[model samples]
Target: MGQLPTDVPWDVNWDKKFESQLEELKQSGSFDTYRKKTIRIIRNPIREGSYKSENLKGLKTAHVSGNYQDIICFELTPGVNHQSQQEKLEEVYLHFIDHWDNYDSALSSRNAAGRTVEFTIEMPYLEEGYDVERAKNTVYKAVKDLDGSRITQEWGDECLRLTGEVSPEDKDVVKTAIPTTVDVKFNENTLF
Candidate 1:
């Protein structure tokens, strides 16, 4: 089995499909954004609630990206050395940077290596006059009831932004729970 170095300059093993997807990102003008996000993730893979990083529930994998347009998914495997009694961890694999539109299908058909699927929802900027904390808690509870993970509540543009991962079937439950006046929007990754 492979072992990851514990110190600086951590190991990162990229999957075979990553190269082609990277080249495509470059051609499409998202390379710069993707590069920055990737670097941030590599520097601190374990950080939680980051706007640029998220933990996918079902797949047992984490992804780093900006605007949710392009995603770089990876899995961290833990290992223990019995003889030396030392704990070790490795970012066993870095999957391809999948586009949002194809992410679901690719994730469904591809080999998850025992990882499951998770549906992420982003609700950005609630309308004025709504209690931000109350609204966030309500949505958070709704998602939690459905077994969601990586729930985050933050303030953006002076308004509340909530993001979390849930099962595909439970997406409607959370959506319906939000008040119509809030203008909840999903991250479709379309610039137009």
Candidate 2:
């Protein structure tokens, strides 16, 4: 998926009529201050304006910076109806990339540094047995999306478990997406 207009940093496109006004600000040097303020807001929006005190979880905020004709604006609203868990998760993933440095999406209760996710799938319902290997790969992909690394994968029949100290994120997404993405009846063993 690509940017959905709801993504962060924002897009600012000034009107053609304002070219002269913009130039005037540049000539007067006041534009430099506005420009820096705009840039700062774009770079780390959550740490700016109203959001300076809060963190994120696919939740976004807005700001209208600068004055009169020189005004620049931004607003973000989550999708009208994220029909699928993946779509909701993809949105979260976008934010996940934005605040990767400042936030932790996955925090294991077992330890400060480790995250654990486990799932088991039973395929006896299918006349043709399901691919256990695909299930393994699915677990790996989910773990990777969680930012999991140095993982310890233990596979049994149709089950997979992961645990390690790799500072990952997206645990909330994992809860819904993993089971749905794998398209299997899943029994979640654990998640962090």
Candidate 3:
């Protein structure tokens, strides 16, 4: 299913509208700077702000720990409601694409050689019966359609990589089977 919005205006008041909400985000000392930077980057550029179920499941965080390095975190909240688990994940998948690089940089660092790098992308989920294969494909589609020019100057492409693995025990929610047939034998001659 297509989880994004339809007929969204490309030009809208993204900043003035969400300013108050963003200010409240600063309470989290860990996310203060990153959140501010994201606002500046997304306000004017991403004119259309819509939610997909992917956004719900798309809740993600990136962390980096090393000498002389402070950890940072980033999350994608599309603000969309998906009625079903699969739909929620799809919404999150789409939302994550909007800020992939921000998440990556927060979790990355430069080595002695001066090349920037991140250890890994950390994404956790609260839903059971989640589909890894489906999620991977969904993310792939999201990043491939990323809009670079619309984002703030601070963001980049590194966060687009879906490099995490699923825990082995993860399972898809069990669904009840539908009745396929009714047992019946007709004895026409014995109908006397």
Candidate 4:
């Protein structure tokens, strides 16, 4: 996994805010409440196929989409290892949206310090009805073929199971562990 940029494009200094909120959340026991806004799942291409003769001799060209979402995350602390945090957030986020919204996948991470997570969440151009789940199936095969393994195989498999495509006998899984609360008595102004 690559590193998410520390210099995010937003007005808020999310890093500082996250640290402050994390402290408060630790005290209050409602950590999930610290999440700023709804995390969005953006698609990133995992791989593509070529029409070349040697590589395509016995194979046909194909396009593959990844199962993982590009999360636009807002956090309450810096202690969360960036990559792991993004991945974990995606895990819980996918389940939450699958149950609550028409969400497919997401790529979430914190913005710059002062910018509100709302700025990105409120992007006017953010189109809904995106086929994130479909993209996941496409990407899974592509990613598996590219590196001989899937980047988010576990997540993909779990999603399939949750949607009833796989059997419990196939794998041991836990898909509903997302935090549900935060420390502060958050009002609109508090933002967490």
lDDT of each: 0.43, 0.32, 0.25, 0.25
Candidate 2 structure quality by residue, lDDT tens digits, 59-92 = 2222211101111223222332322322222221
Off by over 4 Å in 4: 1-15, 37-70, 73-192
lDDT by residue (91-185, candidate 4, tens digit) is 11111221212221312333322211100011112224434354445434333343112233233322321111111221111111111221111
Which of candidates 1 and 4 reaches a greater TM-score?
1
Every model's TM-score: 0.34, 0.23, 0.17, 0.19
List the pairs of residues colliding in candidate 2: none
Predicted candidate 1 versus true structure: per-residue lDDT over 79-144, tens digit per residue: 422213222443333334444344334332322221222334334454565556666778877777
Where is model 3 poorest over a 10-residue stretch in terms of lDDT? 170-179
Error of 1 at 126 (Å): 8.6
Clashing pairs in 1: 58-116, 59-116
- TM-score, cand. 4 vs. native: 0.19
TM-score of 1: 0.34
Give stretches of model 2 more than 4 Å off.
1-130, 148-150, 157-169, 177-192
Give the number of the best model, judged by TM-score: 1
In Å, residue 153's CA in model 3 sits off its true spot by 36
Ranking of all candidate structures by their TM-score, best first: 1, 2, 4, 3
